[model samples]
Target: MERKQHGTGEVVFNAINYTVFILYTLICVFPFYYLFINTISSNELTGLGLITFYPKGIHLSNYIQVLKLKGLPRAALVSLARTVIGTAATVFASAFLGYLFTKKEMWGRKFWYRFVVITMYFNAGILPWFITMMNLGLTNNFLAYILPYIVQPFYIILIKTYVESIPQSLQESAQLDGAGYFTIFFRIVFPLITPILATVAVFSAVNQWNSFTDTLFLMTDSKYYTLQFVLYRYLNEATALASIIKSSQGPVNMNLQNMQTPTSVRMTVSMIVVTPILLVYPYFQRYFVKGIMIGAVKG
Candidate 1:
């Protein structure tokens, strides 16, 4: 193979591209880095705005103390349950509905797809939505998190577009082998559509994991609260939380080293809330662009 030679203009363009991307990456990463360093640094120094760019007086006590906070574990469990259940339900519903809509034999296919897609443009206002959920008995219910998100219009559209891009003959061949729609979907179409499904799953999981608004509106019970909601509350009531910690530990034993300042508490909670999504993002990143591009452009 012949090595391609770069012209001066091409060299300059490459330099600019690398510089721009590197700067952009750092800009995106700095906030998370800042939060992490602040959480691990001395509370006094953090409060004084002294720790930046790197951690100082490093200790794990902030995480330890935050974990010891009341209801944190339960809230984490609730958040995990909803993320798993909601993401699964959303993926399955999107795949099934997306496939179903592509079938010409299905009754009212166009109309139903249109009806579902139209939801992306508009919804009943919050008060009406709340009333509907209340009527449905979703208040303080775990199903509130899972049910409403199952049929997300945008996800359906993405899956539908990707499914349409699959060769029609694959489904035809499965049908010819006496496979029904469900069997065809499972045996053939499903495996082939993994990329798009992964993309949708990432999206659904993040949305489910980060959601706190539903908890605010529908949950009066702390038992049903999610980690995100707990974090939201922690951010709002950082001073109260610090006071609670201080009182629980006894003021006499508490020193500057063991203290839980509002700033430290806020940063620690934010870091805790953000870590999972950051960990999970890289896994799905490979499929994300390819799936979304095909889904968007082909549709």
Candidate 2:
């Protein structure tokens, strides 16, 4: 009887665990699943909220409509450039800064490090921050997206801790070989900390990819709008514009039966904005896991 009771309890426990895991996965995955189905489905079906657990009335018009939106191609190019360039620059800068802070010889290191960390907690308010950035010639410049985030304190701290774990003997040997700080950093330290650098690159790439506040405050021209910013404007105006377009049914060219709806266009844009980051994440997943594990080790 006890054996049977134990077996029953074990079965119940396994069932509960599996149930929770499936629900968790569905919770995480359902939004993207819904978005994809809606994007590929007919606009009328999407507008009717018919894309829940499964797709309905499939069509490619939503994707076609998205490509037709104004300034989108330019915005996409700008966002891609920003993500690549900005991520590269930020990783290098933060690693270098972090490496320097970890060194025994860096003068006033404690005070400087503390000051940088303080900026993480207490931001200069947006108005003042914007003014400062503009005064630094960031306004209307794509550099606005790249420069300010070059050496983020949070990333620097992570890298700094990771750098501290490197055997000091490596640096000592490099010093005996007449290596300068930059030489040791680039040749020796940089290669070994690939995990942390890859992790930081992921963070920087995501930030650059998703950023829109820079575009809102700094860029007045459509040429400089990032994908997220352009998409944001489209979202704000999409419903109203769609209503107008829907109402303007013509006898021949602009037929009501062939019209795309706002819902499908919005879902398509969301997929566009989200897909690149999603695709890139898997490539960095191993590095991210290793880096976090190593960084989590306490001094």
lDDT (Cα, tens digit) per residue for candidate 1, span 1-299: 99999999999999999999999999999999999999999888999999988888889888988999988999999999999999999999999999998899999999999999999999899999999999999999999999999999998888888999888998998888899999988888889899999999999999999999999999999999999999999999999998887777776777786588999999999899889999999999999888888856552
lDDT of 2 by residue, 1-299 (tens): 36544588898999999999999999998888888987876666667776677777676656765776768999999999999999999999999999999987889999999998898889769899988988999888988888888879999999998998889999999999999999999999999899999999998899999999889999998899999998898788888656654554444545333466777657788898999999998899889778867856766
Clashing pairs in 1: none
When summed lDDT is taken over every stretch of 10 residues in candidate 1, the lowest stretch is 290-299
In model 2, the runs with Cα more than 4 Å from the true position are 1-19, 240-258
For all candidates in order, the CA lDDT equals 0.92, 0.85
The residue pairs in collision within model 2 are none
TM-score of model 2 relative to the true fold? 0.89
Please report the candidate that would top TM-score against the real structure. 1
TM-score of 1: 0.96
- Provide the TM-score for each candidate, comma-separated: 0.96, 0.89
Give residue 105's error in model 2 in angstroms. Answer: 1.0
Error of 1 at 174 (Å): 1.7
Candidate 1 residue spans exceeding 4 A from truth: none
